[model samples]
Target: MTDSMLKIENLHAEVEGKEILKGIDLEIRPGEVHAIMGPNGSGKSTLSYVLSGREGYEITRGSVSFKGKDLLALEPEERAGEGLFLAFQYPVEIPGVPNTTFLREAVNAVREYRGEERYDALKFMKFVRAKLKELGMADEFLKRAVNVGFSGGEKKRNEVLQMACLDPSLAVLDETDSGLDIDALKAVAEGVNALRGPERSFLLITHYQRLLGYIVPDRVHVLSRGRIVETGGPELAEKLEAEGYAAYVGEPEAA
Candidate 1:
């Protein structure tokens, strides 16, 4: 198998007839945690949306290969089946649907797509309970409606829980630390740290460096005007925090 978990080459995307991403070239290897940091309107969220197969964005050029397959060619569900999981910036609430029920259906659907057998309710609960416990979540959470009454912290933790249960190969977390307190941030970070391994990779997009203090990504990329203008180690995040993105903004596009 290829060592690359995800590969993007000269990727350009447009939303509603306006360009958002321009020539984004990124490669994420297995077991690497890469963070993308940029100011608002820098196409950070746009890149995440395009990767997750969300609607309204059109890919005008370039290619995205995940696990050696054409990522853009697959539907969103197919991408999920291929072990690509996207943790949304704003997790939506599903009224009336129990968290456990929602997760069970999602897990089973992915399993079916991968040609794996489905788990019954009893077995599914047993499996998910273990994950929830590891994430320091209470069993009561499973009984509540999905994010219906959850606090901001709870919602973020719930996203981490979903990531744990799904066991995705590549997890794209978009601004997961937004609106979270220190305690809640630590909780979410703990869950993420627990899941890191040689078989898994992460793509974290955030506007601040505070989140990097907890997760400590392997590499950091600077996105400006829809392009990745700089790439470096974790120290890059610290520098950006101090110096700000002024240097990168309004610069000429990379050749």
Candidate 2:
């Protein structure tokens, strides 16, 4: 069995026959938080989508082992069943679905997949309410449609709430800090920090080092084009912030 929570070996992927990820390699151990920072179109989101088994992003070479299983072989829902979570850069709004109802169904689906007993209505409300309290979200959020009419911060906070409730083994935040004000960023970061523990791992994907200032990753990687070119400690994020991705992505791409 593999000791790493997420292991990718020479992964290659393409979308609509155009290659995006090229010979990428990464291994995330349990309890570690890793950050991927790169310029736009660096395949950061592609990597996250591939891991989540999103459609159209095809993996043509290599393998991904998550918790000792071949992650690529699993369907998207199956990947979720195996305890993977992804927070998107642009959260989609469901116009008619109430947030509480959506969250309840999601929680129950995961519970069923994990062979655990589903939470009853009263139980679910209690559990979700507590999580909302912890994230400092208002109770009225439950009655509103998912992401509909929510501010950028509220959408991100809702995602944090989902992370708290689902409690996945690996959570991938894909440019979650984008479009957030400083206050919103810190609030979202706090929610993510609260979930950090020995069994949980996080893969934070962003374009800037601003988010790193709050969450403080164990490893920071610089991805250029479609591959990770550099890896270092938290200081790397600071360096990238100071100098920018010029060395890794070149002057034109960095600008």
Candidate 3:
């Protein structure tokens, strides 16, 4: 088995005839958490969408491998089956679909893909309740429509809850800290920290260093003009927090 969880080589993508990602290269190993910090319109979200196989954006060039497989060839659902998860920056609401029901279906789908037996309702409830308790959430959350009528923090927390239930190997959190207050951010960070282990990895995309202060990524990459121009340890995040991305802007793309 390959030690690399995700590998991107010369990845170039465009949306609506405009190129966003240009010659990007990155590799993430198991048990590592890497953060991508970039200015607005720097293609951070685009990278996440492409990895998740979202529609519309075209992969003009390059290749992505996940677990030694051609990730770009797999359908979005197939990507999820491969233990890849993308936590949306803006989670959508689905009325009439109770969160519990949604989660149960999702978990069963992933389980079925892995050739594991599906969980019965009773077993699933017990399992999910434990996760909720771990995240300091209540039973009431399960009964509500997915993201419907949920506060900002509640929506983000609900995303974390899904992450826990899915138990993905590689989680791409795209701007999860956007619009969150300090307390909410802490709660989300704690939930993420709880899930970290030797078997899983994370790609946290953010604009500020405040989130890094809580999660403390193993490495930080600076995305500029849709390319990763610099990479360093957690200290790099602090430097960006202090000096900003101005220094890296307009620099030549990596060869």
Candidate 2 wrongly placed segments (more than 4 Å):
251-255
What are the lDDT figures for the candidates, one per model? 0.95, 0.93, 0.95
Worst 10 residues of 3 by lDDT: 246-255
TM-score of each: 0.98, 0.97, 0.97
Model 1: per-residue Cα lDDT over 1-255, one tens digit each: 999999999999999999999899999999999999999999999999999999999999999999999999999999999999998899999999999999999999999999999999999999999998898889999999999989999999999999998889999999999999999999999999999999999999999999999999999999999899999999999999999998988576654
Clash counts for the predictions, in order? 0, 0, 0
Point out the higher-scoring one by TM-score: 1 or 3.
Answer: 1
Top model by TM-score, which number?
A: 1
TM-score, candidate number 2:
0.97
CA error at residue 121 for candidate 3, angstroms: 1.0
Clashes of 2: 0
Kindly give the stretch of ten consecutive residues in candidate 1 with the minimal lDDT sum. 246-255
RMSD per candidate (Å) reads 1.1, 2.2, 1.3
Residue 10, candidate 1: alpha-carbon lDDT: 99
